[model samples]
Every structure is written in structure tokens, then in C-alpha cells.
Target: MYAGNSFEDEIAGLEEEGLRRKLAALPGAGGKLTIDGSEVLNFSSNDYLNLANDPRLKDSAKAAVERYGCGATASRLMAGDLILHEELDMRLAGLVHQQAALVFPSGFQANLGAITTLAAKDGIIFSDELNHASIVDGCRLARAQVHIFRHCDLDHLEGLLQTHQRGGRKIIVSDGVFSMDGDLAPVSALRQLADRHGAYLLIDEAHALGVFGRGAGLCAELGVKPDVVVANMTKALGSGGGFVAGSRDFIDLLINKARSFIFSTGLAPACLGSALKAVEIVEAEPELGAELLRRAKFLRGLLNEKGFDIPDEASQIVPMVIGSNEAAVEMSGALLERGVLITAVRPPSVPDGTARLRLSITLAHDEGDLHRATEVMAAIALEAGVL
Candidate 1:
């Protein structure tokens, strides 16, 4: 019999590659996780607004937990429908200018449910190649004849639309904000494409919410109307849930058909109430949005001034592409040692040979922190031979 060592040795050979090999050695990430000996600055988390630590949101969660208990005893369809959930959903709909809204356990499940249940049979989905994993998975689950369009490539999208316009049910879907590249989708063009092709449009506003659209999403920011808009409260809302906003009929269709929602337990009162409060904060304190953009611009500029090739964008995500996974991991580790935390994103999060540092900026970080982090990054990059 062959030894298990054979398979182990094969896995060990992954280091010879530049992508997955580096993540294998990544320093600890996440707020609760540590990479290397020091607790790295959290640049990888989706917590964009630092609202996770906001006193108001925390207090809301505490109050709800005290009032409603820790968890829902049953699925929403079976009795988990808390009043707080309805309030949050309605508020999100108002924020996004949608006729109705429905919440889900996570943004991931929201996409899964919305796309799959709504477009399952005889449907064709046109998706951006650079969309988030959840969107890609959702499209897969939809069992649609998924058509891939190049990242933000409106030209390619049009070509696909012309080629498959005969679809019984068709939808064009994309991320409102590309999480890794920190770039905006060509939503305006896509809207035009959807119109031209007679296809419904779905925009996942997970990252865009709270950061763009004055806390709603890019759809509101760009003044574009999609057939559906899905978002997560976890990232910027600092809560743990997702929502899909659309026409009352579309939302109703999802409520009855979305397996992710129908089968899973609903968002607990603690998370729902906290999310409701977070939306209120965004509604009232519009300045937080400007501050977020300002800080992101400032940070990207500092990185560029130090010779790092970061693009100028208002999005919270900033990627510093390093050629090899090994180099990317090393850059993050060295930065951590100097007290600047960054996430080394390697394949399959990114394509092979596109190992990069995914820096997620937040309003919580000040200019001083940016300067200190930039200096550390530059010094570490030079030492690691990556600059």
C-alpha cells in the first residue's frame, strides 16, 4: 500500500508555486487572529467603518441581547421573525430607494438565495469576472447558463448580451465595488447593457454600503437603478447580516423562494437591532462617509509617495500587487514586525502570480496611523526586496 506520506509530500510541493504557497505561510490575520509574534494591524477584515467597535452599535447589541436572548430558537419561517429584523429591512430599503427589502443570515447567503431562487430555471446570468466569491457561487447555484464578462469590461458584456439575448430569463450581476482592486464596477454601462439586452440587473452592494452612496451603496451614489441590490451590514454597518432590496414583488418572490432565508435561522435580535442602529448612524452622520474617503485617499497617496503602486481611489480597499506569493507573505510579515498590519492575499483569492497586499482602510485609522503604517510598509518592502 502507498504511504500517506506520498500525499503529504505532494501537498508540500505547493510552495514551489507563487500563489497558494505564500498563503500557506501567511502571518495571522483577522482581529482575533495573530500572524507572526505581533498582533498585526487588521487590513483584511470586511469591517470597513470600524463600526464593530462603535459604542452605539455595541450598546444596541448589548441591549438587544439583554432583551431578546442570545439566539433565535427557530428559523425565521418557523418563528424567528423578530420585529427588529423588519425594522432593519425597511430602513435598508429606504436607504437604497428600493420598494422592499429582506434580511439574511450573511451577505453570502443573501446572494445565494436572491440569485439562485429568483433565476433558477431557463435563466442565463451574465456576471463580471472579477466579482466576489459569494456572487460567483450564487451564480453557480442559480444553475443559469452563466456568461462571464471581463472585469468591468462593458464591451465584453455587450458582446455576451448580443450573443445570448434569446434567454427566457436573463440577469446581469456584478459587485458594486470590487473588493480586491478597490475599483467601481461600470454600473452605468451595465445598466445600459441590461436595458439594451432586456435583462434584469443585480448589484451586490456589500462593500459599497456605508462607504459609498452616503451609506446606502454605489447604486444610490451613481443614481443607477438595478433590478436588485444586495448588501451586508457586517462590513460597514458593523453588524452581522445581509439584505436584498428591490421591488415589493421581487422581495416577496425571494421571501417565498430563497432557500437560504427560508431554511436558515433568521438574524438574531442582537444583530438586527445593532444593524438598525448602524443604519441610523449612517443616515445622520453623513460626515463619516467623507472622512472615510479622505482617509483612504490619504493612505493611498502615502503609499504611492513611498513608491508603492497603489491606485488613487475612494474605496476602502487598496491592493499592492507583489509577483510571488512568497514575496507577498514576506511583505505582510515584515510589515507586521514593524507594527503595520496588512493582509497578504494570494491565490485563489487572486489569480496565480498576482499575490498582493489587500489593505482595507477605515475611518478609525487616523493620518498619523497612516504615516506610521506607510513608513513601516516601505521599510519592510525594501528589506524584503519587494519595493
Candidate 2:
């Protein structure tokens, strides 16, 4: 279908642009992935609470496997609707104060389902400019006129909403927390605009579940309830999969109309079991949420003191603007050299020349870990002249 020396040609094309993506397998990229016996402090990964390897969560998954077996051989519309899936869905819905919830295979699927199912042929979808990749794709796939307002720009959003208030269904979508920038969306303002325009509000809270809202989301944390919400169990839940929570009628409609959910195999029982346990853990140990925030704050303060220009938001995602993908990658490599792991977020994942060293905090990391990581990053930036 395509011509080139395959891998080599692909690399050749990306080489000049400083973006050669190769699949180099690692033994284990769990809570902390290793390289050449050098432990990079894990600032990369969606396991926001480090629950990926949590013993309790793992045990629950094992128990579920013993009870329910390994794979889901059929789609939900067929023979794959396990009881565990329903239970997890119900509990997740309860967690977010939604009337109902449906479990999808991933956060991406949830976004795809929600955006595609709700908006109709005659609707106008008003979305945030800096929404997640899934939301962006979902908007593209959705059969509606998509109007992207500036990132969290309520004024611009209002302007668009006012212009489109004449007819047709209207919907607004945003992320509870912007993944790359680590900044929160203005959900409160967005909700007001939705109310004024009689539009529905949808939020993808993939990065804001456990660490935010006392274990809920920005909507709950800020006391702003959205009409629809989608989240991932992979990040803070420390499990795998995604979910959509909202009114029972809305969820019921998705169960019927969302092709991604209806045509896909149900979430495995182990994942469902683990997600249930993860939700339980969030409820039982609110201190874990507090600790994660504490660590995030500590890292943010430390990086700021080092003169790294970070945004003034309280989120686990802390980013340092390195200006070049090469510098960003080099900084990540340097941190690894010092026994700390950080990821370089470059173009496609982010805008070009805005490459950043993204550091995500979790309860698993302590002050010593934060201090060590900060010193390592600062040292690397100085050595690389990025400081």
C-alpha cells in the first residue's frame, strides 16, 4: 500500500524533523519502568495515583478472574455482558452522582461514543480548542458543525454560542483538565453558557478523577454539575477502560446508538473488578487523594523556584517549556541518567517548538522523590543550556 524502506524510511523522514518514533520494547513499564538499570523517576504515565500495581486492586482483579475467567469472547450485544461490568458501571455512576453509566473499552471510546451519539445531523457542536485527542477525533467523526473556541475562553465560547442560538441542537464539550497544559477548563463558566444557550455540556474527565473533586472531578470539586461526563479508569482508577456517566435516558440512548460501545466486546471482568476496587479505594482513602495533591503542589513549587515557568494551577501534570523536541527529549534522557524518568511531550502530542518535559505526580511519590527529581531536571536543563 505504502512505499519506503519501511522502518528505516520512516525514521529517515522523521530524522530531519527531530521526531523519529520507534518501538523499543521494555521489560516492564509498570509503576516505574527501568532502562539500563537506571530508574527514571516516573513523571510519565496516566496512572495518576500509582494504582496500576496496587496490591489490593490486583488482588481484586485476580479474584474476578477466578470467578469470571480471562477474556470477553463476545460483544456486549451478544454474550459479553458480564455482571461485573454492570456493577462497575453502577458504582462509577454513583461516584460521579450520575443517574447511569456505561463502561467502554477505553477513555477514547467513551469520547467517541458520547460525541458521535448525542450530536445529530442538524446540531452544532461547540468544543474547546485544547480538548483531548479522543474528543478532537470524536468531534471530527461526529456529524455536526464543530466550532472550536479558544482554550477555556468563555467569552469566545459565548460569542460562538450567541451566533448559533437560532435553531438545531447545540452541545459544548471540554476536558475537566487539559492533558498537556495541565490546566483546568472553566467548567463553571461553560455551564453558565450552556444554560444560557440551552445547550448540553459534556466533559471528559480522564485526568481529573481521583486527584480532583475529593475523588470526583472538576464539576464536583467546583460544585458545577455537567449534563454529561466521560472518564477513564486507567488513570486515577489504576485500572483499564473508560466510562460515560449522565442521565439514565442519555446512557440508555448511548447503549442503543453508540457504535463504539454496542459493537465492541465488553470490558473484561478483571478490569471491571479492578476499577470497582479502585473506586472503593478512592472513597475509603481520601487521604491518598490529598497526598497526591500535596506532592503535585510540592513539585510545582520546587520547579517554580528553579525558574521553570509553570502555570498557576493545582494539578498533577506539571510541564516545563523546553522550546524544542530535541531539548525536551534530552532533558528526559538526562533525568533518566540521574535515576529519574520524565517524558518529553512534543508535536502531535503538543504544538511544535512548544516541547515540554511533562511531570505527572502521584501519591506514590514523596517529598524526597520530588526534591530529587527537581534537582535532576534543573541540573539537566543547566547542562543542556535550556535553563
Candidate 3:
């Protein structure tokens, strides 16, 4: 038998620190879910708009599969460029008010492609300290000079920009809505900083798309256009893929130079078609977006009333910081026992000593769900000394 002592020791360390992650099967859709053979009210998903189970998207996916086989068969550079993919690109570009867009297999790949392709070896990248892992890895892959600024601190970002202004191409990157914190980025401020420094700004809208700016994104809502926009169709769009939208030249460059886009198989046709239908729904039904925001606000208010120390953000993602990792894990278990499914986010996903439960609100959750979840969470948190 093969023995891996180092791997086992590392896993043991993780378990001792309450940072070990185990995958639980989620058999049902968002909102209501079945996990580990138990039904629970799921507040751990990223389906902010609750379109993951929509009949229209299902129908669109079925039709696309029938029309254009199941798989892309090859990369876009070869045989994977389906008409549905082109349609998604066009629609996404229009949504973000960009001149063009390119789809990738995932949001991770999209960020990797956009950042690594745009920021070359000699380029300088200014990234938010709390930016997603994808952006962090992308910067590393680019082999560029990366300066991480304090999260949402424009002054620190400007200082870094000024310090690095004398060199090669500069790229400023951030997430529109921080996935864990659920806080909005300073898009307008970042835009101004980019303009002042003559740098390119790339905003990842994975959590902001379909939930902000009438489903366009945070940049659109703030009335500021970045040099490039990256978004995931899997979250609010209820589809599976990511896309980068920007100037025609920029997108063409990515097509030619982005290894992630060129080497990886193209996005499946079903995902493209379903996302297309999702875009149409978002465009036609403004109420969906409005309702999402309302529900998020309501959930935040409930958490606040219970003294959970939730952030006063407008986004659908809410985090309850339970400083101790062990406490956070125990609280998550208690909540699960109470029929609520909120995952404990610990180190690596979050900063050390800042373990928390990341709560995601969805349009599918009614007022009743919100009330029950908050009540259960509050009781558990109080018992565990987390509130």
C-alpha cells in the first residue's frame, strides 16, 4: 500500500485547526436542498436570483442540446465555437456595455485568461488584497509585478499606482462584489484611479452580475466603465460558464493569446443557451433583480436585529464573523441540526481568526424562510457564544 505520511499529517493539522473541508452532496437545487440524506433550507449557495431551477432555463438547455450535440467536441480555436457561444458573447457584451466579450469554461478560467493575457511579464498589476483566488492565481501566472492594496482602500491603491506608474502596462483588478464579505467595491473610485494612472481596470462581476444594475453589473450601476469586465454565468445567470467583456481589440487579443481560452474545450452549448435565456429573463423582468435586493436587505436586517454583527452591505451575500474556527464549525453543526444549511468558512477561504458562516440570500427564499433561518441561526450563535 502507498503511504503518504506528509499528506496525512497535513490533513490532521487541518482537522485540528478546524480548517479541514469535506464535501457534502447537495442533491437538490438552491433555496431548498437535500444534503447527506437530510432536507434543509440552504443558505450556502451563490444562486442569488434563484434562477438555477427555472423552467425556462431548463427548456432552453434541452433545446440547445437537441440542436447542437452535448459537448463542444473541441476548443474554440478548433471546433468548439458554436453559434450559441457567439450569441452569449454578444448578449454579455451588451449587458456590460462593452464592445465585445469572450466565453470561457468557468469564471476561474475567464479570470485566468483575462489577467494573464493582458498583464505580461513586464506588466504591473494592482490587485485588492481580498480579490478572489482566481485573480490572485492569474497575477502569479502572468509573472507580473503585483502590488496588493488594502481592500477597498482607494488611498492605498492610489499610492501603489503612483509608486508603480513609471513602468510597463498597469492593470488594476478587483471583484465588483466581494464574494465572502458581500460588500461592493469602489468601482467609480477604481475607474478614476485607472484613468489617472493610465492603467487598465478589470472588474470581476461574478457575484455582482444579474443582481446589480438591472442585471448588467456594479460598474453599470455606478456609471463607470472599466477597461475589462469578467463575470460568471453560473451564479445569478443559473448557467455554467464565465465570460470576459471588453473592447473588440482586447477580446480578439484574448482569443489569440489566452492559453486558458485556447487550450480548454469551449463552453458547452447547453450552458450557453440557458445563459442566453437567463439574460432575456433578467432584461424583461426587472422585478427579479429588485426582489433579490429586497430579500437580501431583509435578511441583513434580521441578522442585525439578532446582533450577529453582519455587515451593512446591500448585496445578497452576508457573513457572520465568528472569530474562532472551532466555534464557527460548531455553530454550523448546530444550525444544521436546526434544519438550516450554512457552511463554516475558515482559513484559506477567509483570513485566520476570522472564520464565519457565509450566508447567501436568494429570491426563492420567502419571508418565512428568512424568519426561520434567522431565528435558528441566532439561537445557535448565542448558544455557541458567536453572536
Candidate 4:
């Protein structure tokens, strides 16, 4: 029904603006990987604890497959609610200090379900501007009056909340740690505002889990509890699923009204097995998150000393904001050529004119690895005129 090459023309426009994307087939895992038959220090992964390939997680998954089989075979409401699912739900809730939890097929689905169910028609939602795309999309689908406050600006949020005094159900949502900038949210302040406004608070800890608060996330670190806590096992948990933790009543409401969860198949058995093991590891060794933070600080200091103007954030994600998409991509390519791999993050993932290279540190890297990576990164950045 459309003219030929319409998609091609759109893609060509993206290419011209340096926004084109392609999948790179990087082999292996962890902090060091083989790309194009050469070994490179990997700085683009979310495996903060390097547990994705751990033998314990793998063995747990294998044993689960043998015992419970591979698939859930139906939605949780149907015949798919296994004992493993219930166990993960309980353990994850305990980890976040919540009374109950519900698992979804993915983190995106969790957000979609929680947000839409919490704030329905005639409701009001106050959300952070820099929240992840999943949260953004959830807000869109909520059918509520959505107000986006300035990123991490509590005053702005309060102003918006004050203006919307006659709300049906008011909810405030934000990311625990912003994915691109790696800055932590002011969870305590946000919680205070929510309490003052009589609003339910939701925090997505997708980036902070297993890397902060001894694996419980930013809310736990700040001693601020929200109405809902959202996170995923795919990242630091080294598995594949997302969950929402809250009071037992709220979780029961989600089970009844969250369309995404009600319709989707239950999470696979392998993911549950591996994630259960990952959670246990974090619980046993709470220092893993602290050690990762220490490494992040070390890396940030090294880059700063080398004349790079990365933010002095405590999180493992380090972003070098380049003004142009072309320049950001060029810097990423240059770094790869020099045996270090940091992905170029461009517009839509970040704001326009703020394209960047996001460097994620993992436990697989050490002081020596960070130092070597810093040297290579500095050389490439200098060549690209970013230093």
C-alpha cells in the first residue's frame, strides 16, 4: 500500500544524521570479549557483578531444567504458576523489603503493568523527565493526566503536584539510577514529596539492583520505602525477568488488573532458577555491590585525571557526553579500534545534542584493567577532540 523504498528512505535519513544502528556480534561475555578476532576490554555490558556466566547460576539453571522442565506452558493465572515463581516472588520482595512481589516476563512489561494499573483514567501521574523508555511508555498507556517534572528536581515536582490538587489517584514515578547519566535519584526527597502530596510512589531499580544497597537497590540504601519497587533480573541478577514489589494488597490488585501480566506467559523455569541463585549470592555477600561502587569510583577518578569531563557519580555507569551524534559515534569507533569497547549512545536514548559513550564497569574488571582502559580511552578521546 506504500511506495517502494519508503522504509529505505527513512533509514537513509537516519544514516545521514548518524542515528543509524546495527547489531554487533561480539563474542564471549564479561569484562573482556573477542570482537572481530581480537580481544578487547568490554565496557558496555550491564553485568556489574560478572555473574552472568557464573558456574553457580548455570548449574542452578541446568538443574531446574532437568527437574521442572524448560517452559511455564501458560500464563501465571492459568497453569504456569510454578513453585519456583512463587519462591522468586517471595525472595525478591524480601530483598527489597516489600511485603509481596509479582513477576513478569520482562522489566518493560512490569513497568507497563504497574503504572497502568496504579493510575487509571481520571488519575494523575507525576514522572521524571529522564526515566527509562519503559516508564515513559507506561505513562503513555496509563490514560491518566501525566506531568513530567524536570529530572531530579524535587521543587519542580512539588510545584506540579500542588497545581494538580484535585486528583483521583496520584502517583509519582522515577528511575532509581538514570541509565544514561548514571546519577542516582534523590529517593529520600522524592519519598518526602510523595508523602506530602498523598501520592503513591514507584521507583524502578533496574539499573541499581545488584550494584547498590548490597543488592537491595537505592531505596534500601537511602532507607526510603516507596509504594512500589520495580526491577529486573536480566542485568546484574544475571537472569531474565522483571518483578514488582509492594504490599500484599497492591500485588493482589496487580494480579487482578495488570493486563500485561494477566495475558503474558509465565517466565521460563531456567530464568527463575538462575535468578534465585543470583539473589542468594547477593544476600550471602552483600559486599559485592560496595566493591563494584569502589571500582566505579576508581575508574571515574582515572578518567577525570586524564582530562575527560565525565560526571563524578558513584554509580558504575560513566557517560562522556559528546555534543554531536557523529562525534560520539566516531569516539566509540576509535575506542574500539584501540581495543576498548564502549557503546555510543545517541539521540532518543539521550537528548538531542547530548550523544555520549556509556561506560559500564563490571567486577570482571580490576584496577589494572581500568587503568589500561583509561589510557586507551584518553588517547582515542584526544584524537577525536573530545579531551
In model 1, the Cα lDDT at residue 86 comes to 83
The deviation in Å at residue 279 for candidate 1 is 0.6
Local lDDT at 2 for model 1: 65
Clashes (candidate 2):
4
CA shift at 166, candidate 2, in angstroms?
4.8
TM-score of every candidate = 0.92, 0.95, 0.97, 0.98
The TM-score leader among the candidates is 4
* Candidate that scores best on lDDT: 4
Candidate 2 lDDT by residue in tens digits, 242-291: 99999999999998989889999888889988999999999887667667
TM-score winner between 1 and 4, please give it: 4
Model 3: number of backbone collisions:
0
Name the runs in model 1 displaced over 4 angstroms.
Answer: 1-40
The C-alpha stretches of model 3 lying farther than 4 A from their native spots are 1-5, 34-39
The whole-model C-alpha lDDT of candidate 4 against the native structure comes to 0.93
Selected candidate, larger lDDT, 2 vs 3? 3
Each candidate: what lDDT?
0.83, 0.85, 0.90, 0.93
Clashes by residue pair, model 4: none
Between prediction 1 and prediction 4, which has the larger lDDT? Answer: 4
Instruction: After superposing candidate 4 on the true structure, give the runs of residues whose Cα lies further than 4 Å from its correct spot.
Output: none
Q: State the lDDT of candidate 1 residue by residue for 1-387, as single tens digits.
A: 466658656676665664434234544323333555554566777677778777898899998888889887678879888877788889999988899999999999999998897677778899998888998999888887999998888888888888886656899999998988899998888898889888999999988888887887888888899999999888888889888999999988998999999999988878987898899999998667768888889889999999988887668889899878888888887776666667688877887788899988876577887888888888888888777
List the candidate numbers ranked by TM-score, top first: 4, 3, 2, 1
The CA lDDT at 337 in model 2 is 70
For model 3, how does the per-residue alpha-carbon lDDT over 184-235 read when each residue is reduced to its tens digit? 9999989988998899999999998998898888898889999999999989
